[model samples]
Target: MPVTQAPITPTYADSPPGPPVLELTGISKRFNGIHALNDVGLTIRAGEVMALIGENGAGKSTMVKTLTGIYQPDAGSILLDGKPVVLKSPQEAMQAGITAVHQETVMFDELSVAENIYVGRQPTRAGGRIDWRRIEQEAEALFARLEVALPVRARVKDLSVAQRHFVEIARALSQEARVVIMDEPTAALSQREIRELYRIIAQLKAAGTAVIFISHKFDEIFEVADRYTVLRDGRFVADGALSAITEAELVALMVGRAVNDAYPKAQAEIGGPLLEVDKLCHSTEFDQVSFTLRRGEILGFYGLVGAGRSEVMQAIFGMTPGVTGNVRLEGKPVAISTPSQAIAHGIAYVPEDRQHHGAHLTMPIQQNISLPILSKIGFFLRGHRAHETQIARHFAEQLELKASHLTQHVSELSGGNQQKVVLGKWLATDPKVIILDEPTKGIDIGSKAAVHRFISELVTRGLSVILVSSELPEVLGLADRVVVMQHGHVRRVFERGEATPEIVVAAASGIELESARQEENAA
Candidate 1:
């Protein structure tokens, strides 16, 4: 049977917090005279989940590194239970029972789950020989405690994003951590996976572990956190009990402005179908998928992870091999066997994994944006630097891309900015149909709103969009039509007026829909 969760309550609100297990008093850090953390102070008590909320580039990462001993603070002090201590290095921090689970789980891809869990501190038998059995047993015990199941001998690269996150949490627990700092733990998680993570957090709290929960998601904060701290532009804004604050106030504190209508999806004059996919099938991934993307329309594809949403898009974009389907652009049959062909046929795909598949991280923003239009710009790469800069600047302004300059390398930008760069690169192609897969993944709420507004703007300009996202709110708020997929098949298609959370979720999960159909047939 699947693990069932009880209705979550704010249990920590009943009792007053005891003395803190960890405290940061007047902590200050500067990089080249620019203050990242200026006189910042925080406290995390035993059995408490303290939410650290901030926007992207708001010094949250810096403060985390300071706590984990990646960088020594320029001033102020750290106190553990009122006792001052200096954490000079990551090793010392781990030894002191302070560990972190980063947003991006770092592990050896080639290593087994057990090996990755017990990487630095492997159990040893007599004669200092490695005890592989003990490692696997301990890893299994940890998963059992967390109510997660995975093969201990399986390689890390074979694991899904959610499973990798579990391994990271298990690794932190293996350190005997008194305090675990979880950085954006639910960024890539599905709704069900997020609930399970909350259950895990509850387990840790019951064990008297202090959790520093860092996330940009306010809903998760109010759900799991006992107390909240807000940071803005490298400065401390406020810290209070979760019960004593409202989400609007927290957002105001973080962004220094009130954000009204996060999803500003403007209605556009949707024209005839710009792209058509007829029974598109990919071997082992997705199969028998069909959809129509009309001009100036936002067509959303919603499904659970491993439901073949991304795979279908990849096949449509010519990224996957063994793809069998008929694709028509503007009602004309077009064979897209490669990305270059897709682009030539007025199609652009901004992939889900921007770091790996989308952007040239080491290259400057201008060059990255000019990549698709390199041949169009000039005869040679160096000859059109000026032309490239002009095109990059146009999109940067249109997209409201936040960066120091176009010459800045994409790698140095934050997650939101990097995503904008990826979007800019594709938008420069001036395609009629744009496929955005998880466009706002890992971005802050403010940036998400920005991206949403931009999508609306794109459609208003007579461009069609295929939005694929795990985020239900995004799909419901923006899509003119939503296609719910299950097990590589389009289960149901909901018009904008008909789709709701209840109906859409039921269709995607393959629950209630079949029963309702059976009842209708019986009648």
Candidate 2:
């Protein structure tokens, strides 16, 4: 939302929220006879942030698409200010004062910031020429109003990830958007950036814009949203004020059951060392990184961002060149310089960026799942259709993947399902050692439980796993041993009993072990 010239006093802070600005009743959408959203209902009042709560595959993405006019609901009624309106296309939705900022920032990299803001509908001079100057002025005004200083003339590609998101918000403001949808906006943002976003949301609230905030982070929802709406299996379960319910109740409403443990560690017998890395070195990212993965063990590499945790894993998986490392599998030295070689040596890597690096979005689910093992079968799935389908279905079922059919494109699935598809593809290879980086980054709590269970099952089946994550609890709960990395080096390796949250976090931040213990003891 654009910053206003006047003082930003949130009108909704003390006063009660006003009437509904947007409402959806009896919304239902289907795909190949499968219900994506069934009889879903929602309401968003003016000057309020409504937290759209749901587990992955619980129709959050479908509702977002339906609301954005990317896909028209087969059965539903949308009301704008108490009057029913039809959103036939995205253009119509935008014209009707609704704009969406997706989790994945989609912008024209070649265009300037101002140009991107006014891309489709640019103001014109007398003869319909693009008013570049006016666009820049308006863009600057938007940033000024938001109190964010972004270079309006700079190319979009040159900006930071946070800046690009601000530009997206500025674009929505430029449209005079009355109702804005933010889907996991903080997924890629730093904590400071997230606080800035909260400030922006407050300003938008002050200006009376109804914001639909979609997120799987319960803390974030409770922090920013004024109200709550729950959807389970594509149906409305409840809606009310945030202060009226607890987080556990909200989770239960969204998932249809009580979650006993956020991280359900798998039980497996640990054997001798399965893989060992000695002095793993990258030119810039990391140095002298050494770790060991035992048989049937989940070895976790935990660190803050830019700690070279992912780079070390990538180098081990042979995706990074100029990586000098001595890798031994089951006490036998193995030389690998490419991903195929790594896979041939029983190594698999599930990357962090699932959309770009892990899964092929345009490919069918069956094809994507069978991609890693195509040589074991055949190409194009011509004569090996049954085998491919059988293998795909096996892992999809194990992963609890949701889809219309195995032939459906991965692009059409929700974010959590896409992550599952990527996992299914790599697991199809049946590798002895798998490196999973940020495996549950964008997935919901329920789906996360499913994934945690699956990872536990992997170790029980004798597959050694290396888990890298920025989430502290996940690493602490699931990993048999935690290897803390800071800046490019291993700070400490803690046994399961020794890896306390406070101590591990301090080590990861480059504090001395003794000091960490002292602080822990003091606390």
Candidate 3:
């Protein structure tokens, strides 16, 4: 089993418990004769953060939808302040004081921040005309309350990911939400942004709001939640105060077994440099970036959001325009101007945004898996079905991808499974080098471990990898060498033995190495 850390005492552990603002009793949901949730029960009291933990496909999404009135439970009772109530729709749920800030931060990109915050319930004047002035003022006041600064008049599309999330929270609070559910809120946030979110949650709790914090991150659960509830195989496995349980216990509850290690970074024979970038520069994104990846090695790129790590990766993958760089593969210069050219040059990139860029949601698993190699399988489409199925099944089984069948649509699968399909699709290209950006960003610990093991296996088989991740532990655990970047500049490079959490964090955050060393010495 992975070494267990000391149990952390939650911040609100000793607070006097209040009556539950929302309670779910004997909840059961089914779809097409498949039980997604079975007799599950949960209670969220005011002024507390209750962590909802589960593995992917453990019915956490179903429960969230049911609670938010997107899915009506076949059998259950929802109690609002101990009174039975039925939430027939999302509007009804909002009217009943329930609101959610989803992981994707659903909002209209073209709408201004103030407009998005008050879209459905825009402030009105005497004649029912939109009071745009009131909207902006109220939004500004709301952001001020959260201690966050955001331009209310700016369009949502121009805002950063973290800024958009602040708008989502502001919108939730504007709805007078007494029960605020945050579903995987930190999946895409940087460490600093996550800290700010925690601060905001604390503020919400102090204001008597009940928050349901759902995430696969154990550290977040222990740090912020007063209580935790675990679901396994669509059934409630455990529920208790956060201070009373340990991380090891929580993992066992979620997966029904021990995970020996989250990162199984295998040692592989390091060969000659497989891919090299000399003075790679992207206009307005990143500049003067340089790195080298070797055969059977995992090269990690670490940076905070806006640090231009992803931008650099995209440029290398031929997705960014105006990229000026010299790329060498096996000591030979290669010009990759498009994704097809990159693929032909034996390079594949599994993008971070899997939903929008990685997979074809409407296509079948087999089709998505075979998409990269369709041209090779006869363009006339004669006798291609069996060939496609064989290819899909091969990579699917190789990656331990779980799906109803190869014909199943990618959209029907869970987040973890969809990620697997993305990985499978790329592996089908038989590329010498692969770039995985935030490979396990939103998946559960079990799935993250699986992906890590798979990546290690790929390196062992002589495939070079460039892993871009925001999670420090992941970078430290899997990378043979780490490239730290800050503000579009290469900050530092550390070998495996030399890199530590402190060192990487300092480099990524622009802390001078000598100053960090001096601080360490003073300590």
Candidate 4:
């Protein structure tokens, strides 16, 4: 597929210009005395893809919320088709031809694909009865237009993550939205799925739809976005065409400084096997899965979403039942039937869904960190204030978590800081084997580096780690060895010396190993 062309200039021409599809002028918003957006201005043209680039807590989400009417700006003027308009709610925004697809897929798992596509706005017949047939037919048509295939009657829960993303795009298109905002739409998608999404974006552009693409991935922006806008500390910093700047320049603009290395890989020594899984089988999610994790070694599980990577971890962590396997710690087979059991065995798992699994939104950082290791300090029946303080202090300094005190609520912290608190909680447990799933998702570069360093340090201290990540570069940088999975089975394993981006990708895609390597080298 042909890549989309970048915009010719940063700002539109002063006097000679076409009418903007949407515009936000001098937009400002504040939450509890914190400025979320400061005089931010943006103008999106029809048939163009504008990338909203920023670090976590950089006001990208806030701006998107304002645009979609999720949050009304304290001061601003919105113009649609060169005319000022007031958008009071999300419904109003959609009626005005604006639609948003959030990072978290919002769909009824039990509902059929057709039902999900036309959820809130179902078709009606002459007698005002719901038109199921029409809904299914329309959904099929929408998917066809987007080049996505899905059974209209299939349950959403049965579809893969990438397929669900396609459904989201189809739903948006069905709404006849002229302006679409996709926030990290590719986060859960594989390379092939992302390429497909890019094709859909191209189709949208051809249909004169103004797309707002929000992502932290630099390569995707360069490949698909026409123009770029940077926000920092809730303020607009720069706006320009994608071709007018380089990746380094864009990073500098987004973070307000140069990032010498996005992936700062530190070297560590590998030791004998600390954790080993033999003949692990859990129903259909995994089968005969066997791997050995050495002390001070990072083992990466690289695969597409729904490739059984998370499922295997879930089973090993005892989050799921019906597993027949031999999990050994220091050459001793142990039974792990629950999370607590895994914890007792000196195993820690950082789940992929941080908001749902890692932190309690309403609880303070200290409480979240102290929850796991509460038994370690004694006073199980009584509160251990001193112990809590010591744990918080140790991690607050080590993780560079930004908070006035440990009493600060986890929800009050930024994405990066919340992630730090989660890591701090696990680190406090002193686990010999740590399973991290998507550790760097939605976090900034600085925080990612800090997390990477912590992982390296843990391994150096004789901790075995199972690293599951969607980012290929991260897997390549950190893993001493990589195991690729597809369709609920192990396809290939590559040692550190043999593992490259190409080899890993090929393995995951089910191509011949040697042929895949050659193809990668040729590229």
Candidate 5:
């Protein structure tokens, strides 16, 4: 049995009871003779932030799709404001006061912020012309209400990822949404941005809007959510006040097993440098960066958002042009100008933006796993079916991939499962060095353990790893050495023995040692 974890609990004072803003009962959905959801139930009152907690394949996405009307339930009842409503399409759901701000914000990138917010349902004048003035004013008001400053006239493509999420939220509010669903909204956001999102969620709750927040991060759930709804294996496991459950208890509910250790870095022999980068430069991104990855070692790169960490990795992997660097593999100089060349040189990179750059979501799981080695296996692929299956299944099982079958589309699996497929795909290439960027960004606690263990095992097998992450604990736990960066500059490098959370964060933020010590004293 697992025990309670460190203090990370949310407490909500009881309020006057009222009818639920939204109610779901006996919901069930099936696909290809497999149940995606079975007799699921949920109830959320107005002004409450209810966390939809689950493992990757625990029917959370299915519930979200069903609620958003992207998929109709085979059997269920949905009651909005105590009245039953049938949602046949997303528009119907939106018009019925239920809207969602997905992780990947979809909008007209070339259009203005205000325009994208009111793209489909712009207010019209008597002559049927778009009331542009009203749209801009309303958008400004929405940002003001959320306490964010964004230019209404700015193009959507020019906005940052966090800003794009705000635009989607503003669009939902413009529709006068009664129930707002935020699905992994902060997966890509910085710590500061995540705090801002929490404030916005509080604002919505105060305005009597029922919010359904879905995330794999436990700390976020306990900090922002008032209640909890856990799903496991396509069925509802438990629902209750977050204040009443411990993190260990919640983990048990979510995965039906104890996650004793969130970060279990297995011991591996540390060898001499396996890959060395000297004076790597990517103008306007990262300048004069150098690092060494020893065989059976994990080098962690930690920095804030836009700190040029990923950019440097892209340059190292040949995904970026104009990168001047001296790269040596096992003491042999090599020049990699493209991803193909990098792969051919026994290097693999799993990007941070998995949905777009990491995996081909449209392809089946097996096909995706076999993608990096298609040339090696021959393009004809007529008699290579068994060979592909053997390679794909080997890595999939190593990663603990969850799917009904290997033929299932990558898009159909949950976000964490999709990440696993991507990881498996790259590992199948049998690379000598792997770069995992934000490997566990949106993964569940249980799955995070699996990935960490896999990374450890990789090192034991004599493969080097470069891990780039925004999460401090993950870096401190898994890394042999920590490199901090700020404003495209390498700030400091700390060995595992000397790297502390405060010191590393201070370095990343460009804070001096004395100042950090003073701040700690102030605290």
Candidate 6:
């Protein structure tokens, strides 16, 4: 099936003078019975930021994977500069002037920043030996071009998460890629970092490099995208210049329905604190961080990447060692030195990276769901299959997880489905307080709604939650109170009604919201 390209209105600074740098036509792909993509067509012009929006399982990822040679299309044709080309591997894609920065930063923690930047293609000197001095100088030059300041000689692990993300971008710029694909690039960045990234994108546009920007953030799309393309049900639905549409309309195109309301928050009555931390101090990540979570309340921790949000959750979950803190659950101090202790005391932590920490991908969904509470029923042989099945079925239905059965392998599921499994696993434990870090990252619109609904249900059941999210909307929508953190410390707190994107961004960037408000008031 051929997708009809919507007539683009001439609104921006006009199409570039050069030929289309990249073009894909009749791109079709499938896995088993699932049609991952259906005859998708796209064109990338020089010096333009093309935003791709879609629901989960909408084939946005499939199209990119095919373009980058991670998955060859079952049927399709790709043209580079009007000439047919076959990108059989990632190396081929890079050699063809196509590069990508994935949502997850890919780098070697043990290596120096310079080394990681130019890992495979290092500058060589005499005798074909790697030229260390030239590599450092070139890496520094790349960072300078992207307006990123970092020590090229420092180990990658020593830098902050946002810094590491910039290093990845610097690496891409080092290649001088003509077409760059950024998948949720700002998903883990602060407002300052995001602004810096937009500046770099502008530079790339000025340099005549085409950019494919993928994000769920509507404000970012409107702010940075030159044109927009929406995908739904593995097919292209709409495309045009950004100015041709409103945010609500764009969201409708992506989800294939009107989103009259993005946030569905309902106020809850205040009550006694269910969990409290008094003078919590970790060795280095944070100090004197004290807060409380109450029953039926959602407490949001907002911060830039590496601002100690995850570290705080770690301490509360008993994963951080050498922590001096007095924690009380229901007015009683409890000794929590490990995850088991924390779980026993009714605390659950859903980590940021589900692939690495949340669940076992190769295991059956039932096994993963029952793993956390396995000790109570004895290993796989405890005759708890009936009970486990019931629990898994309940959550699967609750989360609307798509799978054949509880015996299905989690690895075969989609990103959103896998996330539901992680959530189900934790919910089975029946914890008093749940700590969620980036719970909706990479999930599609439908799945994101399901997760939000689950959170609301949890709170209604009198379970307190501490949510750490990179998406500001999620924080504002779900949190009863918001705490903004910066450089490993709390910067400010906002009541439910006062939390806004502008206010949170200002706080995260180390600017006093009240001072700005006072200046505005005076004006």
Evaluated against the true structure, the overall lDDT of model 2 is 0.84
Task: Sort by TM-score, best first.
Answer: 2, 6, 4, 3, 5, 1
Question: Positional deviation of 42 in candidate 6, in angstroms?
Answer: 14
Q: Assess the local accuracy of residue 516 in candidate 1 as a C-alpha lDDT between 0 and 100.
A: 39
**Candidate 2 residue lDDT tens string, 1-523:** 1111222122334325566899999999987556878998888888889989765457888998888889999998999999899988988999999999877789999999999999999999999998889999999999999999998989998987778889989999999998999998886788899999999999988888999998766667888899888887678878888876665455445434322367787789999998999999988889998888999999998876557898998888888999887999999999999999999999999999999999999999999999989899987657799999999999899999999999999999987889999999999988999999999876766677788889878999989999998766678778999999877899889888777665565576554445456655776
* Best prediction by TM-score: 2
TM-score of 3: 0.59
lDDT of 1 at 46: 86
- Residue pairs clashing, model 5: none
Model 3 residue-pair collision total:
0
Give the C-alpha miss distance for residue 231 in model 1, angstroms.
22
- Local distance difference test, each candidate: 0.83, 0.84, 0.85, 0.82, 0.84, 0.81
Candidate 6 Cα misplacement greater than 4 A, ranges: 1-262, 378-383, 512-516, 519-523
What would the per-residue lDDT of candidate 4 be over residues 371-483, giving only the tens digit for each residue?
89877877555558888888888998998888988999999897888999998889889898899999987787677888887776777666788999876667777788999
Model 5 Cα shift for residue 372 (angstroms): 9.0
Cα RMSD of all models vs. native, in order, equals: 9.2, 9.4, 7.8, 8.4, 8.5, 8.0
- TM-score of every model versus the real structure: 0.57, 0.62, 0.59, 0.59, 0.58, 0.60
Greater TM-score among 3 and 4 belongs to: 4
User: Model 4: runs farther than 4 Å from truth?
Assistant: 1-261, 380-383, 513-523
Tell me model 1's lDDT, rounded to 2 decimals: 0.83
Q: Can you write out model 6's per-residue Cα lDDT over 1-523, one digit (the tens) per residue? A: 1112334443544557778899888888877545778988888799989998775457878888887878888888999889998889988988888888887877899999999988998889989999999999999888887777899999998987678877877877887788999887886678988898899889999988999998756678878888887887788777778877765455445444322246566556668989998878887788888888888899998876557889989888999899997999999998898999999999999998999899999999999999998887666675689888888999899889999989999999988899999999998899999999899877777778888888867787778889998666678778889988876788778787666555565676554445447645775
> Candidate 4: deviation at residue 368, Å?
1.9
Candidate 2 residue pairs that clash: 3-145
lDDT score for residue 103 of model 4: 70
